[model samples]
Structure formats: structure tokens, C-alpha cells
Target: MLGPASVQDLGRVGQYRFGVGTSGAMDDIALRAGNILLGNDENAAGVEIAFAPFKLRFNADAAFALTGADGGAELNGRLLPPWWRACAHAGDILVLKAMSRGARSYLTVAGGIDVPLVLGSRSTQLRGEFGGFHGRALQPGDILPCDRSESPDDAGELGAEPADIALRQRTLASGARRIRVIIAGEYDRYDEAARQLFWHTDWRVTPQSNRYGYRLEGPPVQPIVPIEKRSHGIVPGVIQIPPNGQPIIQLRDAQTSGGYPKFATVVEADLWRIGQAGLGSRLRFEPISHQEALAAQAEVSVYLERLRASVRLQGEL
Candidate 1:
């Protein structure tokens, strides 16, 4: 049978036209751990479960791991935890439940998910609806074929967590409780109180958050006086404050330009956290020196080393 991170039904997602992207690991940190457990590459394509559990009947017995965002996974009525990699017997049912800690979870199989690599990756960009599982969510009766490539047989349960990332990107740094920002264009448009509120107040992640941007709902932190300035190119992590004063942080899939006035930007290292935070996650920003931001990146490199250490690669059978 096949394994995790293996993009099944390659070119299937791209053919569907599901807005241009298909689903991969919502939290890649979790997925990479699963791959390492299976002795596979981090890009190994698997079904990225969002808000629901994952269920797949293997054509053959294989080894796999479930990492991150506990959704009450059970194998033939036996409950399990995240960061677990074990061998599932043929016909044994592996079931994942709704989220308990994180919003999404990753399932990696041995030998990797054996989908034809399109454009060098099997990640389903569901927005583009290209690549991975017919460019859509895993559907029932979808027969995922296994690759002939054999994986190591590591008999154990262990892995590192996604929150373990030590890097504080220049683009997305946070302090567990507070988000940070780097002032950008249109910063001068706001008055003193507006600036204070923008930097010093707590905000709520609105239901409108997505890959395109994070819409933070908080007190109005807009310009006390209006300014007529042309729109400029927008980048991921830029906080675009409109007349309403609420800020929207753009993400990887965000558009290139916008007309709204932007005040600040989220640092780089911590940007991935936004994906992990989900729609209802409470958020607030903090200000940091540029040197601190770079230092955070160094910290991130260390954390990654620790995570790599925890990976239990499968032994040669």
C-alpha cells in the first residue's frame, strides 16, 4: 500500500479549478515530523484534514504517523495521541476525530504518498485546484494507491510539536501572547492616539481570516485625520488599516497591491503561527527592535535542530 505525503491522484486537484490551490499541510511543522518518523521527505503529500477527521482504507498494510492537532484518532477502536507513528495492519481502520488542540493534523505513511510530482511538488493548492487528490479534499471511496518504494520499519511513537519552532522571523514574531509589527507605509496618516491603540491594544482574529490575510478586529485605530495617498504593493504580514481602523495582515496568497493605508507589518519568523491559530484565535501585536527580529530567527534554527532530533526514522526492513 501507499504512505503519507504521497500525493495521490496527481494533477487531479489542478484539473478541478478549485480557486487555484489544493490543500496540503495546514501546519507543515506537524506534517514534517510525521514524514521524518516515516523516514520520508518533508514534502511527502498526505490528505490535509481541516475541521474533520481523516479516514483512508489502505490497499495493503503499512506504517504511518499522526502528528499535530489531536482530533481523537483511533485505529480499530483503539484511541491514540498526536505524534504517534505505528504500523497499521491490512484492513485495520485508522480514524481521526474532530480537533481537540489544533485545527488540523498530518498523517504520513512510509515510502511517502506516491502521487506524480507536478511542478516539483504534490501540495494541493486548493485555491488553484491543482495537484493532490484530484485537487479537492479526500473523498470516500477514493482509492489511494501505494508506491513500490519500501520505507523503513520503525516501531515506535514519538515526535516534536509545531509550536516548538524557535525561529522569530523578521516578518512574524510574537511573544506567546502578543504579536509584533514593523511600521511600514501610511504610518504617518494616523494621529497619536490611533498609533498608540494600533501598537498597544489587544485585537481579536475575525472570522474573515484566511490564507489571503488575517482580519484583526479591535478598537478603531484609524487616522484621526484623513490623508489622500495612492495604494502601494502589499506584502504578507503588512497590517493594512482602513478607515475602520482594524488591521488585516496579509499572508502567502495575498494580492500584490492595495489602496488602503497600512500602518505596520507582522515580523517574518512567527508568521506560520497565524496558520496554526485558526479563525477564532485571540491575537495582539508587540513591537520589537530589528536586531531582536534577526535574533529570533537564530532561535528558530535551534528549535528546528531539536525537532529534527526527535524524528524516529524507520529502520531498514
Candidate 2:
């Protein structure tokens, strides 16, 4: 019931088989962090807000956590920080300022949003218009039902541990963004010069970038010889090169398959970086071995486990 633009439920995972796009949160790490703060399932439904000077009036008391984007959240006129959790009484107004960093923010309420799950997920597939809050972005006067009963007493006021706050700051800090890629599919088709250019050149995200894919603007990457490839199954993170020589990084809402030549696939651990990268952001690619990719994922798992353990311990306090 608030925003300056584009809000949707953070993606539907595990339902892509029905030709549905996995339209979840762009910054999954933030979504998981907020849910953990509120003791909700890491994948529990939450709102993904983009480009916001967002405001919402709560009609009921609730515990909520705000994560992603340093939007300068305020509850009842009191300033709040990202990764912070707090309580809101009935009629309290929550205001989130425009994004200062990162492209999206997540609002995870305790007990999660009480929307009917379709195919085991509550994410909105904007293209298909199903699932999520009436299959659309929330509007003013729209009443969203939440599972208030599922909220635990300690969910609010816990805030973020000093360590957690530091972690978020470090991850979202501005700098030359390096995204790791595990080489896959048709990578050999490109000539040596193009391959070197891919790794060494800085690519700028064009305005065409969206949840569907990021169309990058940089030096053209051309294959040594013309090749025609049939469309095959593809998933998020695959870098496809079209005839125009521009690179397109398929995202959560990407089509299931494409005829474009696939050069490289971003590792799962680094997709969140892409999600937070806005138009005009500079990105560089780093090649990693398959083992390195697996290790990266393992590191993420350990970090999540620590978050879970910390929340559990706090609940017992």
C-alpha cells in the first residue's frame, strides 16, 4: 500500500517448470536477512520495493524488519537503519526514503505476508499475473493480510547484531563491482581477443536492464566463426550474446530458453550483486573454477547458518 514505484513479492522459487518465471527478490541476501531478523523462514514472503520514497500506514500492530538499500527508514517519524527490526502499533506510519545504495529494499514482516501460495510460492509473476498479493503490486487502500499470530514476542526490538550490521555495510559498499563467473556453454566460440575483452573490459549496465535481464553496454564480443545454436534450457545468470554482439545476462524473469550464444554463467553466490547493480553501474567479470564456485556457495551457507543460530540464541534470551 505504498511506494514511489515497482513493488512485488520477492520472487517465486521452485515454480519455473510451469513456464512461470522465478520472480523473487532481486537482492535475496537482504530478503533472507530480514526474515531471519523476524524469525521467519528464510524464503518467507516479503515485499521487494524499488526506487522508493515509500510510505505505508499499518492498520494493525506488527513486527517488521527492513533490509537492503540504505533508504533511511522512519517509523512514526523516528529514524531507523537498514537491517534493523522494530515494532509498529496500529496506525503507525512507516516511511522509507529514496535508495542511497543498492537498487531494491525488502520489507519482511513477522509471520510473513498471508497470501495464498501458488505452486508452493507466493512471488508475483508480473508477466503472467498470478500469485502474490492479488497477482500485482500493492495499491493504496488495498488491505494486505498478514499472519500476525505467527509473530513471536521477541521478533521486534532485536534489531541487528553489530556484526550483522557490519556485514551488510561491507557487502553493499560502493566500489568496482566484481562478479564471479563459472565458464559455461559456447564460451569457446568467442575468439581469444573477445574472451580477453570480456574479462578485462568494464561493462556498464544499460537502462534496458530489469529483472528479466541486464543488457550490458561494452566492447562487442564476437565469435571467431559464425555459429547457429538451437535454443536450450537456460536459467538465471547465463550470459547470452546476441547477433548485435551485446551481452545479456538472464535474470529471474528471463525466458526459459534462448537461441543466443551463451558465453558464461554467473555463479549462484554472486547473482545478488547483479540484482543490486543499477543502471550505469560498472561491472567487471572474474573467472573462477567450478571448485571455487562451490566453495563460494558453501561460504554463503555458513554465513546464513550463523544468522540462524544468532536469532535462535536471541529468542532464548
User: Could you tell me how far off, in angstroms, the CA of residue 105 lies in candidate 1 after the best superposition?
Assistant: 1.6
lDDT of 1 by residue, 103-211 (tens): 5566778877775566546765445555666655456677775563676554555545555324323432443345666777677777888788876666777777765
TM-score of each: 0.77, 0.91
lDDT of 2 by residue, 100-183 (tens): 677777888988888888876788766777777877766766677788888766455766542224333233234557889988
TM-score of 1: 0.77
Cα deviation at 207, candidate 1, in Å, is 2.4
Candidate 2: the clashing residue pairs are 10-24, 10-25, 11-23, 11-24, 11-25
Task: Name the lDDT value of residue 4 in candidate 2.
Answer: 23
